[model samples]
Target: MKRKEYAWAYLFISAPIVGFLLFAFIPLSYSVYVSFTEYSGYQAPVFTGTNNYAKLALHDELFWKTLFNTFYSALSIPIGMVVALGIAMSLNQKVRGIRFFRTMFFLPTISSVIALTLLWKWIFNDSYGLLNYLLELIGIQGPAWLSSETWAMPAMIIQGVWAGLGINMVLYLAALQGVPKSFHEAAEIDGASGWQRFVKITIPCISPTTLYILITSTITALQDFPRFQIMTEGGPNYSTTTIVYYLFQNAFRYMSMGYASAMAWALGLLILAITLLNFWLSKRWVHYE
Candidate 1:
């Protein structure tokens, strides 16, 4: 009976294990091999050692530019987190119709990215855009957001923050809900002001959630692609072209599979390093019960 149970357990789990080996592990291994070779998608991969990485590091100006762009755009992560926390706090209120407000706040997260991008593209238009029109009403002239190099990345950041706000807000809302009301009551009884209680009691309890949001948001920001592909096409002097978008261009558009694979490995390593660093530093602040 014990042997039969173990066999059945393995059998039940084998499908996903096989799928992982076939789809994820195999492909990942192949990509590592490909990254060390010179190959277009159509050609046989030829061993090229570290040439792709060397070229990306020392020769490709666009690589550095896009890396910078990626980080710059990733600024939205913190900005969105802050804004989302506020929204989450607001939604956590016990007032009537709070559920409706929560749903409204979370709607954009579940909506189609393409549709949101298109809507933002229209909103960022210099001529007769809703954003510009509103600015104009205040006697201010809105710049050509998508067409201007200086403003394009900021525009992308704004849209990114808005688009991601709902999910982050939801996560924060859940975290806020998980916090014990008893702690707040204790702090209050000790003559702690609302702000003091929030600072001393609420923030520490939510630190783990904040760390979670930070790590995930950073990964998402670093891997951002679709928004730039749709909204900017990396235009206005490639100011909005992130690393992932560049990797996509090399792999699909330029047909440089090997180089793209190298980039993918590089990006993967970067993400790994950052994630490890987050975990390392989390010891200082992230609290769990």
Candidate 2:
């Protein structure tokens, strides 16, 4: 009977285990190997040792530019966090039609990504776009948002912040609701002002949620690619080109698969370091109780 039970357990897990070895582990191993060679997909890989990495480090000015642009665009993470927290607090209030407001705010998150990207592209159009038209009404001319080098990255950041706010707000709302009402009541009894209660009680209570949001937001920012593809195509002097976009260009456009794999490894290390740093720093402020 025990043998039969063990056989059944293995049967249940076998497919997934095999699938992971084939799809995940094998591909990962090959990618690491490929990073050390020079190859187009159709050609035999020629071993190049550390030349790909050396080129990225010493010769790739475009890679450096893309790295800077990616970090620069990550500014949206903080802006989104602040807006989400504020809206979440408002949504937590005992008010009529709050559910309806929440549903409306969350609508964009449920919409198709391609559709949303195209919609935002139109919204940032130079003359006929809604943003520019609104500016005309106010007697201030709006710049060509996605077409201008200076404004393209910021435009992408705005779209990202708007698109992400609803989900983060929902997470914050859940955290807020989980906070003990007794804490607030006690704070009031101690003559704590509203801001004081928020700072000392609510913020401390919801600290774990904040840390979760921050870490996820950073990871998302690091891998962002769709906005560049749909909104800017990393144009306007490649002002909006990010690391992923640069990787894609190297892999497909230049047929530099080895170079792209090296970039992927580098990006993976960067993300791993940042994630570990977040975890280490979180011990200082992420409250559990």
Candidate 3:
């Protein structure tokens, strides 16, 4: 529009644009360069072409394991989504004490992640763990949750789901609340059952939020590190090591900055590809109102 309006708009947007270029694009470009070299942070990066990726792909068994574990742990996303949606539905009712229950459900999400992770670690301890103790009282045996290769990833997934349930539940609750009651009432007049109303009306109406949560949850799962690191240390046979954890070890613990940068680039590209795939697939399912 007007020149003065343009000037004011530019002034309002300038800081964030400058910040993003300086802090985001510049570092991203630098990391792309670093990924092609062999810099250990103490010395200049020596150009190495695709050796790092080749090494990671063909030679690093732990890399494959970590990659697998990362995807495997992400299995919690769908499970968490179902549970969250169920809880959100229940909370969407106009029942008494609903606000209090909502606050309690959301507390875990806003609480200290470190403290919660430490508590979960203790709860997974083989003998004295609250979980195993309860299982014992029920005449069921519990495996070494963090120590066993078979169970460690599941343990991490459980912690991830428990800690993350509140946020996703809140998201679904918001989406549910946005749905017009008239739609359900109209469907009821047509003799549509509760399940039919939910499936044909509610789901399509909230598909946008569902798609948003699914993509974000998947990306977050790919890069999740804190809970795994604090609770399992990538654990008893590297069974819990994820791609991000592997990248961290190579970057800081082993001091392989360039290699870690390569891993970072790979992870970024993977996330981009998956996100693109989701957006493309969304056209088939996600309906916006």
Candidate 4:
């Protein structure tokens, strides 16, 4: 009877498992196979045996540039996560209309990416943008935000941080609420100052949430694509050309499918390496009790 029950339980999940194998696993396997071949999408994939990777390594300057851009975008992860945690903590306090503020903060996460990108594009516009207007009011000259190579990547980073902040804030809010009230009260009775209690108790209790935010935000920053394609198009001397954007251009624009496949594999390996490193380091600081 137990065996039959177990069989039925597995049968219920079989459809999704089969779908994963067919749609995701098989496609990934085929991409890996074709990375060694020389083929555009239209032609037969002839086995070239690592030539694609060799060319990408030896002569592809754009590949390295795109990788560096991705790294720069990822640099904001720590700062953004700290900001999100602060927002979450403030909202978790004893205050009225908490739901209203939470909704306001979270609505941006659901806004259309294209719309938000265009909105920020105008905000960062050199001529009549709000940013320039504010800077002028403060007696400071504003630089071109999206048009100049120096400001284009930073503009994208600002937008990326804004777009992602809400989701991470909500996650931290939930974690903050889950912490025991007894801990905070005990710290107060022990003559701990507000900052000391926060540093010792609040931060340690929230380490798991911090770890979660760090991993996901870093990955999102590294893999951002849409605005890079639509807004900058990797322009202003390739300042905003992220790895994924470059991969899209190679696969679709240049019709270098095999080389694109090689890039895709390399990107997956890099992300996997970073994620594994985060997991390994979590043991040192991420506390659960």
Candidate 5:
């Protein structure tokens, strides 16, 4: 009867587990297999061993360029997190209409990302746009934001931060509130100034939240592509061509399935390494108490 009960327990979770294996595991396994070959969706996959990887590592110029773009975009995550945390800390203080402001901050997080990107495209329009118009008010000429190669990635980064700030800010707000008020009071009694208290106590109390935000934000930024697709299409000389964007172009557009799979694996490995590094470093900074 005990064995039969265990069998029944497994039966309850079996369907979802089977679905995950079929939909996720099988595709992932197939992609890994395809990465070792030279298959263009239509042709029989020809095993190229490590030749594809060698090409990317030793010969592909675009590989490095895409990597740089990915890095460039990720820098915005830290900048956004810092700004959002500052805003959240202030908003967390006792104040009237705080709930309304929180909702306003979180509104962007719930909106459709596709719609937001389309709207930003117009906002960064070269000829006449809200951003350029605002710059004009200050007697400063705005460059073509999404069109200029030099400005395209920066424009996307800024838009990404603006759109995503609310979620991270709310997360920090929760962390801030979780901090025990007694600690702050004790520090004040000890003659600790505001800056010193925040640095020594508030930051330590919130370090775990910071680690979580850093890892998740870095992963999201590294994989960011949809905004790039809608805004720049990885163009203006491939300046915004992140690895994921290039993978999409190669897989769906050019039908270089094998090459695209290789790129995907490379990106996955890079993300894994970065995540591991973040975890390792968090040991020193991510306080639990």
Candidate 6:
């Protein structure tokens, strides 16, 4: 009977297993093979050993530039976290219409990404855009945000933070709710100030959630591409190009599939290293109760 049950369970799950092998595992394996060869999409792959990797390491200045842009854009992760946590704390108050306010805050997360990006693109337009118009009213002229090398990355970061705020706020709100009232009450009785209770009790209790957000946000930031594609198309001077955007360009535009594959693998290794580092560092501060 147990054997029959196990067979039935496997039978039910086999569809996904087959799909993974067909769609994900096969492509991943082929990409690894392709990374060692020179291939355009139309031609058979020509084996090139480590030449692609060597060129990336030694000759490609754009590789380093895009990598730098990727990490620089990740600055939004910590800024978003702090802003989202503050928003979550504000929404946690017990008041009428709080649920409605929460919904408003979270609406952007469920909205269409393409639509949001398009909207932001217009908002950052150099002339007659709402942002620059507001700046003009304050006696300050906004730069040509999406066109200026100095400001393009900052524009991307601002949009990224705004678009990501809803999801992060929701996650932090859930974590905030899970913290026990008794802990705060006890701390209050001990004459802990409001800020002390928050810093000492609330933050520790939510450390696991913080770690989760940090890891996910870092990965998302590193793989960012859509905004770069739509907002700047890698930019006036390649200023906003991220690693993933550069990879996309090589694979599709330049027809350097082998080099793109190598970049993909390098990015994967980077993500893995960072995630492992986050886990290693979490041992010191991520308290679970």
What lDDT would each prediction earn against the true structure? 0.94, 0.94, 0.93, 0.89, 0.92, 0.96
Clashing pairs in 5: none
The per-residue C-alpha lDDT of model 2 at residue 75 equals: 94
Provide the RMSD of all predictions against the true structure, rounded to 1 decimal: 1.3, 0.9, 2.1, 1.9, 1.2, 1.2
* Total clashes in model 1, counting residue pairs 3 or more apart in sequence or in different chains: 0
lDDT for model 3, on a 0 to 1 scale?
0.93
Scored against the true structure, residue 145 in model 3 reaches a CA lDDT of 98
Each model's TM-score?
0.96, 0.98, 0.94, 0.94, 0.97, 0.97
Better of 1 and 5 by TM-score: 5
Query: In terms of lDDT, which candidate is stronger, 3 or 5?
Result: 3
Model 6, CA-based lDDT: 0.96
- What clash count goes with each model? 0, 0, 0, 0, 0, 0
- In candidate 3, which residue pairs clash? none
Best by TM-score: 2
* Window of ten residues with lowest summed lDDT in model 4: 73-82
Candidate 4: tens digits of C-alpha lDDT, residues 1-289: 9999999999999999999999999999999998999879999999999898898788999899999999998766876788888999999978889899999999989988899888888899899999999999999999998889998988887877788789989998998898898988998998889899888988888899888888887777777898888788888888989999999998999898888999999988888899999999999998998
Question: In model 3, what is the error at residue 125, expressed in angstroms?
Answer: 1.3
Error of 2 at 263 (Å): 0.2
Model 1 lDDT tens row, 157-181: 9998998899899999999999999
lDDT of 4 at 239: 90
Stretches off by above 4 angstroms in model 5 are: 1-4
Q: Which TM-score value belongs to model 1?
A: 0.96
Residues 64-126 of candidate 3 have per-residue lDDT tens digits of: 899999999999999999999999999999999999999999999989989999999999999
True-vs-predicted CA distance for residue 80, candidate 6, Å: 0.1
Off by over 4 Å in 1: 1-7
